[model samples]
Target: MIKVKVSLRPIVSKINLPTVVKTTILPGDSIESLFIATQVGEIFYIGNGGIRTFLDIRPRIIKLGGSSGGYDERGLLGLAFHPEFYYNGLFYLHYSVAGTQGPVAFSESFKPNPCDPKTLNQRWINRETQYDHIDTVEEWSLQSNGQPQKRRTLLNLRRPFLNHNGVNSLNFSPETGKLVLTTGDGGAAYDPFNLSQDNMEIAGKIIEMDVVKNTFINNPPVVTRFNELPAPIQETLTVMAKGVRNIPGISFQRFYNQYIKYVGNVGQDLVESIFSFVHYKPIPVTQLVQASLMNSEPNQEGFVNFGWRGWEGGFPTSTKGGCSENPTLDEKTIAYYNEAVNTSVSRLKPLTSYFHKDQRPDKFGGTALTGVQAYMGNGIPDLTGSVVFSDLARVEESRSPVRGVLAYTRVRTDGKLNDFSVIETDYNFGSQSAYYVSLGTNLDQTKLYLGVYGSMKVTDCNQGTVFEIVP
Candidate 1:
């Protein structure tokens, strides 16, 4: 990797935490405009040299940061414009619904132990009253008068934890022309119930929905699994992949005629990984349901898996503790030996994996992966045709004035793991903490955007800034 340096041009400042930042052409507009979706259910766009509120659904969003000590992962997490938005004025949104929070699924934190079979095979029972919150997907259209209105409800999902709901979760696939939704494993540590690998669970899978085929259901049932959905609604969905721990979002980079899909899976105490693939076979929800009812396995020959709850990036999932005798050293134990062996051959290898604790002088330790985008822009010549990503914050001993990290990596032709280089930026934040919360690109991938927050708490309002990655 080559050394790259860029400048952050501030677009807007003093706003709420942004979850999604992308460009789309508004109805009757001649050029594309940058749209920013905040975690508190507000969408703003920059047009005619000023920021304007495009939509506000705060009344409909669940109360955020109440149970998590002011830090939250469930709010307005997704926003996507239809491919024909300029003419059709259609768009989609994914967010946690109001008045739907429930009791925690478990009384205590979860950790898997290989010696105890019961701990390894815990089940999520009494789901109706034992969950964290409900997230809803909706379709909205821009009216002729330029205001956005809700068109229909697409799907409602039940999450089991307060975190790992996935940030920037909604996107449109350029190849198949379908809306893609990437979800995290129902969020206790180590996926206590193994939801990611289960074919019936919807928490940790990548699904595609055909919005063109309306199911005519105004109020869809809130469910946790594939078989519980209405038949008509199930017919419009297909599962693309599973075994996800948590994801920032998915990106599609055009390569000749096909698009190379890029996904960043946030790691659990080990390594942050980025996976790329150009081919996959998505299984329809109807087929999965039929197979479940018959007690048979669906054809998973061409399906994709990220190998969660077993393997974390390039290493088998393990627990770490300090060595009693040798105080300077740490002890590691494999968390799930059988699961690692079972998924070893089926999971896709990541293109690149960065460690949580790196000793190399050239590399920095990563905390959590927040965003990933492919930059095809010529403004930063060295970063053209490369995949760029953002970390919430680097791992360091000091806590004050925390700063995030930016890095870039490329796909290799030999299908081997590649290394990345840090991208230094020219910006002065003084003594304020800056956490990179989100990343986005234009429709053509010719421009890049970065969302930075001054604090980690979503309740700390008016502490965000949107910046353009410029040369």
Candidate 2:
């Protein structure tokens, strides 16, 4: 890793919290334009020498930051343009639907006790009445008149808790030419229901939907599992991987003729991990449902699994507690010992991982992985061909003004864990907290974008600024 320092040039300011940032050309445009999607359900594009509203779906978004005490993960979380958007005028969105909030799956915060078997194997029952909210994925098109309108509904997912419904969730897969949706392990801490490893659970999995297939179901049923979906919808989806805790989004980097996929799995308690792989086999949702009905195991050869609930990054998932004998030392108990062994061989190894608490002077402790993208731009030569990522905030003890971290790492050719180097930024935030909420790139990934917020709360309006990482 090389020491890299860059400048943050502010492009847009006074916006709501940005959850997704990317670039796409409008139907009639000749050049690519930057688009920013806010958590409060507004999409703006930099065009005509000013920030213009591309779409506003606030009325359709669930009321945010009320129940969560000024902070929330439920809102407009994902936005993506079609691969052929220049000709098709198609795009997709994933957001928490308005008027669908319900009782949480668990009445209290969840922490698995390894000594108590009941806590370790709890199931999510009474799902219909016990759920947090519903997230909907839909296809929208920019009409000939230059107005965006909903084309059809793709998926209506029932989420168990308020968090872990991924940020920057919707993306178009270049390899398969399908729309990819990456979601979290239905939110409660430590995955109380163990949904990630379950074959039927829709949460905690990377799914690819073939948008070309017209299922004709304009309004899909709101369901938590794959078995509950209509057969037509099931036929169009394939599961790329499972055992995800929470993900920022998936990024694809061109490597010769193939694409290298990079995914950042937000840590549970210990570490934040970024995994890269060039090959995978996706299993159709239909086959998984049929296998469950027949009580047979579907062939999982070439499948990708991150091993959540059992393994977090490169270590076994553990619960941390202060040591009784030593007041300063923390004790960690393996949360799921049995699970760690079962999935050890099948799960994919992370390309790089950074700790929540690091003692190294050169590394900063990570709070949460906000975004990850591969930068192919030559503008910053040191960061060229590297995977760049952002953290919500660095864990600097007793720091007055909290600041987020920007770092880069490279994939190893030997399939082993690699280290990351922090990319120092020259921009100063002064007294305000700057939480890096999201990261994005242009159509060709030759440019990088950073979304910074002054506050962590969604209720804090007009505190966001989108910047470009420049030399």
Candidate 3:
């Protein structure tokens, strides 16, 4: 057993369900500022040597949940920066709103009251049926002072329910120059609506969109809405990659001549997995589909389905069935299993599996595996090419190696995962469960940020925390 030593430093505590900490550089700045977001709809930053509010959409968030909603899985979820941020003062955000709005047009004054309790705090609650309808991707341009000024609505996801509606792993790869969208299997247990396997639905999928060529000139940052996009782009965005329960952890690695994108998809009852795709170029979805179509291929083959309801740790016998919304469509696993390994298709397999039971006998930890990043910095050579990530779970502070927060593994050239180890095991992150964890950036990409989502995995206005991990 290889023992790993690390440290977790406190950057800011008492955050309100901190989901992600994003960093970007501006011109004439000695260092980049870190933008932190809470599930309650607040965006703040540590820049210009001071902490300030970058943007706040709390007033507009529908069904804005807190502990009262039993630890809502929604709210302001992820953020990103333009590649040329120093040149263009722009960034992007992903947040959920009441589907009751039903993918409406963007309005400058469209703020509406949501899940009214007249106030927000620890005791907040909203029904999955009540608050979640449409989750959106938005672009914002900053004023000269580094605060957001204007907003543009990009992709609008008119979702099915609230649970798992939180979008994450929002990233801008300098290599691809496009925004990668990570969505969950459209809420409810077992992907109730079958959104994950729907070719036109954007749930439980990995989607990419071009940001340079698609927006309004006066508005600044470009966008391609889900409905308005070309067929190829839309098809690329949704291939019905059934079985992707919810992919939260995602990061990119560009080695000598290969660009590897790593993702950790969380399973419902048993399996937790990490998989990678070698996407060197920002390939058009249309082309991949066109080629497959020209060759007469099944969409399932090209996309990997990790078997959400169909397969689990104890899959064959003790498997959980499909979601409640459409049970008949997912009745049994005969066709599902055949679809997963269908020979005519180009199915992707997991590098390794973290079975709930021992997570494959060599797995490090279990449950709520949120995000993964392949160590790309030279500061830590041993960690290079290794996948580093955090989990979402509440554990006894005394349980070392984190009862369920952070861990890492190495990927051999053959795509097999090496030994897994817990990071910062000696440190106590919080009694709260981690809703999300991601890599952070400084002058160098040498640290990771753990956003303690708070107890019960919900955002408690006063209980959430954000911690910084260092070598």
Per lDDT, the best of the predicted structures is 2
Evaluation by lDDT, superior candidate among 2 and 3:
2
Alpha-carbon lDDT, every model: 0.92, 0.94, 0.57
Most accurate candidate by TM-score: 2
lDDT of 1 at 267: 94
lDDT of 1 by residue, 337-445 (tens): 8899999999999999898999999899999999999988888899988899999898888666899999999898888889999999989998999999999999999
Candidate 3 per-residue C-alpha lDDT over 419-461 given as tens digits, one digit per residue, 9 for 90 to 100: 5666644555445344444444433456566666445544345
Candidate 3, residue 456: how far the Cα is off, in Å: 2.9
Off by over 4 Å in 2: 322-329
Give the per-residue Cα lDDT of candidate 3 at 362.
Answer: 33
- Model 1 earns a TM-score of 0.98
> Would you estimate the TM-scores of all the predictions?
0.98, 0.98, 0.76
When 2 and 3 are scored with TM-score, the better candidate is 2
Q: List where candidate 3 sits over 4 angstroms from the true fold.
A: 66-68, 98-131, 215-243, 279-345, 359-365, 378-381, 394-403, 428-444, 457-459
